[model samples]
Target: MNEKEALILKLIKEDPFISHFDLAAKADLPGDRVAGYISSLMKQGKIVGRAYVLPEQRQVLCVGGANIDRKIWSKGVLELGTSNPAESSKSCGGVARNIAENLGRLGSGVSVLTAVGEDHEGHWLMEYTRAFADVAPSEILKGHSTGTYTAVLDQEGEMTVALAEMSLYDSITPEFIDRKWSYFASSDFIMLDTNFPADVLNRIIERCRKENIQLCITPVSSPKAKKLPHDLLGVTWLIANKDEAEAISGIKIETEGDFFRAAETIIHKGVEKVVISRGDKGLIYFTEKGEAGVLIPPAISIIDVTGAGDSLVAGIIYAHLNRIQTEDACKIGMACSILTLQSIETVNPILNNQQLLETFKQNFK
Candidate 1:
């Protein structure tokens, strides 16, 4: 990577979900000209995916929301009076962007098809995403004020109450996405988040089915996690946490057995497979043919729990695209998730096939 390319990469690592125009401004280049440089870097493998720039490789396309996550840290969980004895931070967030960044770090050709605002953070988010992966601006709809989530953290850095402003994406219509259907159709794998409107998701699901693309939909958080489109059966993989699993499938999960049952229910509902995460307890996966699970003991300490699921999805897709068996895929997903929980920000840790296999053997065996 040249100086400019290296600079761009640094900027991307600093902001994985930023836009192209902001990159041009930060890199001090004309907008159109900077876009050309980005394309060139992508062609040269400096940025190797369908994510930030135009499509040139068999990349993963993530369709979801991108947001600026603002967190406020206070004491006593806002119940026992305000005891300020902590820190606060702001970071790039959003399910699709998180997965895209993870895929890029894992050395996958990743791209994102999502929407952000025309405002400052939105521009920064777009530039960041482009720098990290292949984010096609054409697919990113403007005018909609970008979404944001504000969380109040307690002493332990655990979020208490989160106010998410996601209604801006309520207007993502099928007509808007019709323009970028080609990118969506050619992706090796398609990951969806419930952030988009139901109709838009329906259109994408229908299109992906027609194009023979594998779809993975994340219900995201527990509260208000939308159910998979009725036609989503057999066409999409269900990724959800224990809480989300219960909400979408109406299955009560009090133990590991319940988790497996929830996953099985989704699988029987038309999903080929389901991965349900029981944080700290590890993850359990159930596929159409059989059921298996893996437990990678927690890595010493947890710095931040954000983006861990996204990283796991990247690992799963990596295994899937590489034709690795389902069991092995779950292991890879677990390994990657552990690595992300240790890092302060999301990063793609490039591991060659041999390296990943070695890590798998040492960690799991």
Candidate 2:
């Protein structure tokens, strides 16, 4: 790496999602010349193409569900058990998939693993996701249908009920994880969602323990949250919503004190850190470093709440990679959640590192 290449690489290291134009401005070079340096970096294997994985920054594998999400929002007050006029939208979604996409959007080296059917939907899911996270480790199951989730929301965009057809996820077994062991072995961090079964989760958690890799686990919902083992000895972070938190901790959370108790319970379960999201009430977090607090998001109009939590996880991971403080990392996460709440899409198309930092500074400071 010569002087110019060294300079560009330094800028890239600082800003994972740095644009070519921004790089040119920072490097004091011609805009068109930035591409050549990027190309050279790619050729020299100093950085991975598109995702820009540098040797110093290890990759993360997000293991869990990947599927089609169909959302239906009622145009007016929803009536129970009756047909109501609604507007519907469809998009690529799933817990791990959304988190991986958000991480990719924020310029992290991330790969998503899941089971998709050998059908057009499966093909399109993999191809569309490739634009964000690496989907090469995902498998396509023959003679099986891809999983799906359908959510019904009220006019306020709050999900009233949801139905999930996620049987395909059963195919993502321990053997499947073994097949992708190389990815896990090379990763410095690994993220898992409860969409995987108990054995699969336990296997990966144990391997992460053996490898001494950092692990973050997100439970998909209240029911699936039970999939986690009683011994969470190797888990680094357990991020969950209030209901899911209640399920995991066996605590009925009706007040602020209950929330803290729940987090403490999970921490005692051997998770290094615990964060329980309280929706509009803000979030409560207890970190491994002994930083604890509640962060309430600044008021903003919410267009949709689909990917807000996933974006929060992405923001924390981004902050950790950048060496941000733990409390502020949660603040960045709160900022990311607020940004995602303003978007109708699952993952906000306009999200980047700069936007997230700006939002953090504006709202949190």
Candidate lDDT (C-alpha), each:
0.73, 0.86
Tell me the lDDT of candidate 2.
Answer: 0.86
TM-score of each: 0.78, 0.84
lDDT of 2 by residue, 206-277 (tens): 888876889999999999999898888879888899999999999999999899889988988889888899
* Clashes by residue pair, model 2: none
Q: Write the per-residue lDDT of candidate 1 for residues 201-296, one digit (tens) a residue.
A: 788788777657788888777764763565566455677888899987778998778888887777777788888887777888888888567554
